[model samples]
Target: MTEAIVIAAQAGRALAEAARRAGLRPYVADLFGDADTLALAEAYRPLSGRFGSGPAAEATLAAVDGLAAAAGSPVGVVLGSGFEDVPGLVARIAERHRLIGAAAGTVAALKDPHGFAALCGRLGIPHPSVATDAPTDPGRWLLKRVGGSGGNHIRPAPRGTAPQGYYYQARVPGRPHALNFLADGLRIEVLAVTEQWCAPTPMLPYRYAGAVVGGASEASSLPAATWTVISDFIERIVAATGLRGLGSADFLVDGSDWWLTEINPRPGATLDILDRRTTPLLAAHVAACLGCMPALGAQPADAAAAQICYADREHAPVPDLPWPDHVRDRPRPGSVVRRDAPLCTVLAEGADRQAALARLETRTARLLAVLAAKKTHPEEAP
Candidate 1:
């Protein structure tokens, strides 16, 4: 079997599973060596890094080299998240192995706040204003890390100067939505538009919660002109930046008015909800990177949702409960899970978006309840 290397903070499970679906043996290295990820991957290596902080370059390279040596002529590497902040590390990885996604320059350009804002302006796309220095009206702006994912790096802009590796972006109005698409350096094939919500805490108000696949009803609610604008923006940005393979463009949408947020230049969190097609998306992603846009299969008939189940309090050694089939990215039997850290992902499907999200809520609540009960009854098998 052909082998591929998968790396990310926590999203490696989704990518590793996708690689298996694509008929590739995946060798994975990530921050979290979840039980499901270990099962999906042929070989797994645990990275010594935290989420939001990019993986250490030397350690990541060593892990990749070890995995590559174990496989029988591996195909290449498919990065998920955590490398966006350090494009130089990405370039270094590409030097040692073939990269099956966006190039280093592309990542650097898109992750650069000033460069992306300028590109949006040049293309006549609506984007929130960005500045390196602190805004006069700090209340109207937000501070964001240069190449942050998962929204934990965002906060209300404070008065005075901006911190290093962070910039201020004018706050915009609207709900969070993302356009997941596959690009072949020039053209793009949109896969799905997902609606995202936040798992807010006092300190990290914008931390990502989950996403639901947009169903037919949700699609009909948006005006046709909104899609046209989105298409135009995608076409322009792909042509300008040479973005390749799986990518997601985030947007703030309210009625027909929309503002382009940042672009995640790799397979994003929505992959869990959106990668249900007959043709494996990883195959399409590899083909797209090779400059051939494969015919995308039809979207799943039912709406699906995936939500992260964060630990309410710290678990020094998590109880070995009977995890349901719908739960994914499961931690090992006796592992430490910090408060506010992701414990596992709960997935659900239904007739429509609302129904799917409702099922997700029920599943999440039940899982949390189970964990709490298990904590209280330490000897319980469940």
Candidate 2:
């Protein structure tokens, strides 16, 4: 069998590792080419582009074609983050290779602000009020790019001149929640519900921080009405979008009221929490994308949390330090890292969501301190 190809802005390390556990060699294309991901992938190519902006579609196509030729057959592609802005490019890629996720048309519908809102209205799914024009009160609304992912394109509205391809959404107060589900176009299977948080910095208030996955036991504590609302909304969305394969629905949950925020039509960051080696998620993602609805086995009992560690200030990358086993996504040495840019991802686990999140927070703080201290005394670092 030809190896699977995974592409994203930063090719997901979790996804690449899951592909390996699924017994398939993965050829990955992305911008970062992080150390761990490169080690796991059969071959790695760097994607040329910035996040939030559209992907480098031409470079991706060239890389995929080369990989397919080297493999002696056409390899299936599992697209990730950056394609959200380039549905046309996705369509072009699908025309040449087998795509293992939402088709181009589906992506267009989900990523289009007006189209998604209309779909939600048709299906009676509760969505926040959205408008094409900036609101009178900037504090009451947020400006969001139509195809932005990773919270990079969101900001308080009524600020300086808004960027192109932006729309305004009524700001709602609530904790962020994401529902990871697998679908076979018509049917939907709920995999896990994760609590997501933003690590605010001076430059970006909604910078994606991390997520705690699973936590069904913890979710049970919410009002019964909350589950009903979430379930009904998920069912309606699947029916309306005809989404297939690994996907997630982002929500802002304030008490029992839930507001649909965004639809992620590909494997998302929450994969770190839901991955089980017994039934690796990448294999399931591919299977679902190929028109099969794989069974969602029981979620793991222990919840997992993954946090993005950001650089506090402009710093020259330190030499090797005693990074903990849980650390991944480390920035390369001698690289100049800007403030608020992600330095690495730290992972931790506990029996429940709160426990996992707390541990992750503590671990993250310690890691940041270590990084800071190591910068001061590079000779002490290993």
Candidate 3:
């Protein structure tokens, strides 16, 4: 029997790819088991309709059990995007299998805005102000879903009673950057410093657009002293939280000060951008969880980028647009996707960050145009 790794997440395609790159077979269970992800997995299960009004943990556990039965005890379980809203469920899953990432306690603490803000204060890490209630000055604070992933639930605070799972964060100004790293529960190794941006729709003002790896010309124009401070800050966080596996720290770079934004304590979207064929990141994540640290090299100078393309209007993917080789997580034909739903993930590499990002945007535009045109002329779709 082939030894497989179990991957459960909102979207398992990227994590599955990471597992495959690491030379491990994956048994995947996720909300969207896209065609590509299904093809890549040794076995697959869909976690649809398991959790409606309740926490998703039940469905998540069921998925893991199903996958494990087929794969005969996976190496470990890697939880991706979807579990932020239910960290307790993550803890429950960990009890059954060796989780290849942060523990439930670490996740619970870091995900709580109020608790994390307090942690920042205790560690002397610079962080923006946070509150449970909506701020009187909506313009100065942003409302965020406490454990939301990908920037979908963040918006300018509105004047009203705060939502059940929402909190207010003082809006900080500067270029948004994300730091990807690997930790061994106590020590950390920084991987890549990336530029994060958003593509707003009618509903999502900060829909996660994409990220460019090696974005800064030399990993930020900030001086060595500033980077040293950031490094120390990350080390302190690792020491305090005992975070393990692959994770990324979101930050707002204001001049020389790097304001910590949020911590994604799981393998994130940046996995695609920073993936090196020779050094699959999932391997490092697995190693880290098992008390081993992989020697991660310094961030490369070459620029690579990944963008999530969303449907502008209700339209099906064009059947004959000669879909580029760089796209992943592609939707099935004639699926009748709704507006603002993610269509696919586009990737590009260039000599510099600007060039790579421009290429990705152009490619995204071309794909969207094709989808729109195909919708207008159904006969031309094929």
Candidate 4:
């Protein structure tokens, strides 16, 4: 059987599981192994062994090379979650193995906020207004790192931080909406739109909580606009970047208008919802990354509105498990109560958004404590 290379442990779990279920061999890269991964795929290499010291370059290269040889042909490299610094490295490594659909150069574009913002404008996509050096007419603008991969560190101008090398943008002022999409350059399949609300306070306190402070449910349409501008923008980006695999774009909605907030170049926090509403966007993402377009077509998630729920999110404060070593989305060690995969994902098939949400709320209350984290994640918006 043919094989694939997945660089992330937590982020790549669904993809790895889908691949194994489809009868393909999966070689995961990680620093260590865990019970969660035992049934999922094979671990090929530990990234730390490669990055810990510059002198270990030869050893690192050898380790990745052995993995390429083992996977054998048309390998697909998944960059994993929270990996923003090594697009060039990922490109070089994958290209050497003749891997298909590796968009290293395109991903590098994320580094330039001004250039990327201009490009988005040309494509007729809606991006929040921005200026790198504090525009003369600063309008609630924010200085952000184009290389921001995700999690905390994304917030309003919080005094002194990445002062010099930062990109600026007008913050979208409304509830956050994220769309999970699978694209193969030629086609883009939007699977789900998750609606999230933050607490009056930032989720946690200042970014140590491993979990989200408030609650999140799947949303169907922007309150007034229903996200048409944002939807068109994603299609434009797919055409522009030729980005393959699954990815997400976050936005802020003000009435009917939606403004782009950030981009996650890989599957992110919405995976659990997607897997519940749709048949794992990862399966199709992997296929697209391989240049293979499965016959699957796009559709709204589970009957107009799918109600996905989460409570007691883990904060980043807990010790981060070794990179590339992911357990199913479960409660962390300090978690007084154990949790299960998804906590609770309810599909209100054929029900209106309200009915679906009601059912979801009732179901989630039954399964989770809905307890806020003792600490908060810095990047979490209020």
TM-score of each predicted structure versus truth = 0.96, 0.93, 0.93, 0.68
The list of candidate 4 runs beyond 4 A from truth reads: 1-4, 30-34, 48-63, 72-74, 98-102, 134-139, 159-161, 197-219, 223-226, 276-280, 297-327, 330-382
lDDT of 1 by residue, 1-382 (tens): 3555545444589999888888888988888888899999888887876433345677778887788787757777888888888888788888988888999999999999999999999999999999877578999999999898999999989987888889999999999988889999898898887889999999998999999886644553346778767977897899899999999999999877899999999999988888888888999999999888999888788899999999998888988777899999999888899999999999999988889989999999988888888888887755
When 1 and 3 are scored with lDDT, the better candidate is 1
Candidate 2 stretches greater than 4 Å from native = 1-3, 51-55, 159-162, 214-221
Cα lDDT tens digits for candidate 2, 185-264: 88777786777888876667888988877454555434667766676677777777777888898988887677898899
Off by over 4 Å in 1: 2-10, 50-55, 216-218
For candidate 3, the 10 contiguous residues with the lowest summed lDDT are: 49-58
Candidate 4 overall lDDT versus native: 0.53
Best by TM-score: 1
Clashing pairs in 1: none
- In model 3, state the lDDT of residue 345: 94
> Between the candidate structures 2 and 4, which one is better when assessed by TM-score?
2
* TM-score, model 1 to reference: 0.96
Residue 213: error of model 1 in Å? Answer: 0.9
Per-residue lDDT over 136-205 for candidate 4, one digit per residue giving the tens place of the 0 to 100 score: 5443655565565433345565543346646666766775668767778755776656665432225322
The TM-score that candidate 4 achieves is: 0.68
Ranking by TM-score: 1, 3, 2, 4
For every candidate, C-alpha RMSD to the true structure in Å? 1.8, 2.3, 2.3, 8.1
